[model samples]
Target: MAQSSDIEWTDATWNPVTGCTKIGRGCDNCYAERFAERWRGIAGHPYEQGFDLTLWPSRLMQPEAWKKPRMIFVNSMSDLFHKEVERAFIDQVFDVMERVDWHVYQVLTKRSSLMRAYLHKRYGSSAVPSHIWLGVSVEDEQHKGRIDHLKQVNSDARFISFEPLLSPLHAIDLRGIAWAIVGGESGPRARPMQEAWVHQIRDACERDSVAFFFKQWGGARPKSGGRLLDGEEWNGFPWQIVPKSIIEQLSL
Candidate 1:
């Protein structure tokens, strides 16, 4: 089954792969790891392995059963590009996505370089399908290089998630980007995000003609700080990249 998500940006979550190891400070308080660890040692639980990297080939065809078109966040529980995930498994995931072309799949990852390399090898000079949107996660200025990696991909549906915006990305370039989602950390060890940091990216998006969406002001809880930014909500989306067929079905 495609898990329905509470996340504001996407409609559902599909986890063909689960579990990941930390490679950066952004992974310190990962929400996926936190949730999965709770079920450790519990028999019959999906996360019984407690965040140990595992692949579920059974779930690859899960999306094919869903009739209605929607935005599906691929691998919400783990990164598809994680080094441990086999290239064959990743190919299976992509195959399912290509076959079930009705839903828009958002494949986000912090492993930007690996993702770029894989996409280049898979599609080569050909354009990636519009139904599959590729994106990378950027937590701070130090990791802004991920954006450059994302730009190297040959896809029109490119995006970036600036969640847990830890530092100011002053004068950051947003060219060749279709959308950006900004939000603060939300958990027990949640770090504070400065308003000045958000303005920099929002302004850059405006200047670059990229759609910007402010997810939350995250606190102890996901909604502890509310979604308002400068007295209004920012819920921008890139409708241009969405396939016309999906858009038409969504309206119904």
Candidate 2:
């Protein structure tokens, strides 16, 4: 599916890939897997395969058709770097982003090591395109290495999604990160997030000059608890890292 998105950090979503297998704690209650599984066995349903990791070659050019320039979150329903996804397919996805150049793409994944390797092989000595912002998901301190992997990639618009923030991440090093989005889990079994934990991350981002975005203090529903952090919303965006050309286009 390629259309507008409700994700606070992005303007739209383009999923050339769909369905995914759980990789870590953050994925324990994946909203994607849950939603996909609901359509299992219902022939004709997009997720009839039931979160079985399917690729859609037909949707590769979805971004190009939308002439408008906006921040698009690539593969929101799946991980592009999943081991099952062919490297050739990943190349095509990258090619579309390159050709579309006008729209900004945010490619976030929990498969950090593989992502780093792919970036190295694709861009090599050259820097990654600024419009293609690369990011990783960090659920807690245990997955902090994902951040380290993100830092290793040679991209100016590197970001961290501390979503489903299960625990404190005070030790995370936000040095090379341009932006950080923090939010709690939301669903039937949504976990509660401590105020102290969020404050710590926001404080760290401030100290490092990193743009911080506090998405939600999620509960039963995404907006159940509201998105206020200490009486104010943390909507810091990494506008400084946006590509000059894309920024100009958006301004127009």
Model 1 misplaced regions, further than 4 Å: none
Candidate of highest lDDT: 1
Q: Give the worst 10-residue stretch by lDDT in candidate 1.
A: 243-252
lDDT of 1 by residue, 140-237 (tens): 87899999999999999999999888889866999999999999999999999999999999999999999999999999999999999999999999
- Model 2 alpha-carbon drift over 4 Å, by segment: 248-252
Summarize candidate 2's per-residue lDDT along 63-180 as a digit string, tens digits.
8888879889999999999999999999999999998999999999999999999999999979998899999999998898898899899988999999999999867679989999
Evaluated at residue 129, the lDDT of candidate 1 is 93
TM-scores vs. true structure, each candidate: 0.98, 0.97
Clashing pairs in 2: none
lDDT of each: 0.92, 0.90
- What TM-score quantifies how close candidate 2 is to the native fold? 0.97
